[model samples]
Target chain A: MLSMVKECRRTKVFKPVLDHIPYAKFIGMGCEQFGDEYIFTLPSNDNNLGNPTLPAIHGGVLGGFLENSAIIHLLLKLDTPRLPKTIDFSIDYLRAGRHKDTFAICEITRQGRRAANVSMYAWQTKQSEPTAVARAHFLLEST
Target chain B: MKENNEALADFCQRGMADIKHSEVLGIETVSASNESITLKLPYSLNLVGDMETGALHGGAIFTLADQTSGFAVFSHLHPQIRIAPTLDLRIDHMRKSTKGMDLFCTARCYRYTDNIAFTRAVLYENDIDNPVAHAVGSFMFLETVKDQGWLK
Candidate 1:
C-alpha cells in the first residue's frame, strides 16, 4: 500500500494536478492506486477537528477530496485535455469520521462526453465500515 | 450607510482570501446589510467554463455559501474584528441550475449573537421563487484568530 501511494506521487498523471492545489501542500493529500480504483488519504490536520474533545473531519474537506479525486481519475483515464467541473454532488455521512488516519476510495461509474459520474466511500484506519459516501457528477470542459 | 456596506464588502473579500478557493471564483459583493448579501458569479468562473449547459459545480456553491454566510455576520461586526470560521454547513439540492446563466446568491444571517452566528443562503440563476439550492451554516467567532492555531 505504501509503495502504491509512493508510485502515485511520482506519476505524471497525478503530480501536476496535485501541484496546482497549494492547500494540498499544507494538508498532505495523497493517493494510492489499485487496479481500477484509487484511495485518497489526508493526514489529520488541525482544521479537521471540531470541538477538540472529539476529532471529526470537516465535511467540506471530505467533499473537496472526493470531488478532486473524481476529476483526477477522469483526467487520467480519458486523457482529458482540460479541467472538469463538478456539476452536482451529494454526500451522506453514514457515520462520523475518525480523526486518526482518514482515507476515501473512489469508483468511477460512468464517463460521458460532457459529464462523468463517480462515487466514493470514506473510512478511518482499522475500521470495517464506511464513515461517509458521496456521489458526484463532473462536467468536462470541451476541448 | 452605503459606504459602510462597501467597507463590509471589502472586509469580506479580504477574509475570504484566506480560504484560497475564492481566488479563482473572484467573489465580489454587489450589496449587503445586517440581513443578507448578494454575490455574483460569471460565466468563465464556471468549473467547466460553460455555465449555459447547467454545469454549475457543488464546490462553487459550497464556497459561495461559506462566503455569503461569513459576510452575513462580518458585515455586522466592528471593522477591526476578525471573521469567524465555518463550524458546519448543511445544503440540500433542490434542482439543477439553468446552463449558461449567471448565478446570484442571497445569503441571510438568521442569528448573530456573541460567539456564534447562524446563516441560510439561497442560490438562483434567474428565478427567485424557485432556487437551485438551499444551505444553512454556522460560524464561530473568535476574539483573536492567531490564537486559534486549530484553524491552520
Candidate 2:
C-alpha cells in the first residue's frame, strides 16, 4: 500500500508544470483519469473565442488543447515525469468548434524507449463526430 | 490590384488583432502582404512547457504556426471567400526553443484549387535562416462576404 502511494506521488509531476503554464490555466484546461483513459476538459470562456463573426473558438486554442492533452497523458501514464518534449504534431479540423465546454481524450499509440506517439480527439456535442483529431510524437526524457 | 491589396492588408491586420485568443497569447503582426505575412510571439512564462528547462510549450508554438497558416490562407484566397477554416495541418518541431527568446513565423499559401488552399510555414527565432519548426496545411473556403468586396 505504501509503495502504491509512493508511485502516485511520483506521477503528480504534471501538477506543477501545468500550474506554471499560464496558457493552460487561462483557458481552464482540466483533466480526469478514468481507468486507462485520460480525459481533458476546457471550460467555456470568452477569451478563447477567435471569430466574433461566427463566434467560433480559435483554431490555435483547439490545437493547443489537443497538444496539452497529449503532454498530460504521457506525464501521468509514465512512471517518471521527466517532462515530455514534443517532436511533431498533426491535426485535422472536421467542423467549426462552437462556443461551449470542450472535451478531449488522448491515447498513447506507441511508447518506445526514446520516442512516444499520442493520438488525441476533441469534441463538443458528439464523441463519434469529433470536432478535431490530433496526433503527436514526443521525445521522453524520463531517464 | 493595389486597392485590393491595400484593403486586404488592412482587413487582415485588424481582424487578426481583434481575435481574442491572439490578444491573450501576445501574437502581433510584424507585416502583411498580398501573398504572405509574418507574426511575432514574445517569450513569456505564460507559454512555458518545461519548468525545469524553461522551454516554451509546444502548444504555444503550434498556435503561432496555426495562426500564421490561417493568415497565409486569407492572403491567398480570402475576401474572395468569406472565410477559410483549417482542414488539416502537420507540423515538425525541429528543436527546443531558446529560453526567453521571442518566436516568429512566416507562412505563405503556395497552391489553391477551387475549394482548397495549401500553405507552408516556418517558425524561427533570432536568425530567420535557421528555422525551429516547419508546417504544411490546407484550408477550406466558404461563402463570399458582400461587404468584403471580394468579387470587386
Tens-digit per-residue lDDT, A1-143, candidate 2 = 22332354457433454565666776779876566666788888888888776678898889989998887777667754476788999999998899998999998999999899999999999899899999999998756
Best by DockQ: 2
Chain B TM (all candidates): 0.79, 0.84
Tell me the spans in candidate 1 whose CA falls farther than 4 Å from its real position.
A1-32, A35-37, A41-62, A67-103, A106-143, B1-4, B14-19, B49-54, B147-152
Write down the lDDT of every candidate, Cα atoms only.
0.62, 0.80
Best TM-score goes to which candidate? 2
What is the C-alpha lDDT profile of model 2 across B65-87, one tens digit per residue? Answer: 98888887877555554467889
**DockQ comparisons of all candidates to the true complex:** 0.11, 0.61
In Å, residue A65's CA in model 2 sits off its true spot by 0.7
Residue by residue across B24-138, what tens digits does model 1's lDDT show?
4566666776557887666443343222354555555655665676567655554546546666566665766565677778887778778888888888877868887787777
Supply the global lDDT for candidate 2. 0.80
Docking class of 1: incorrect
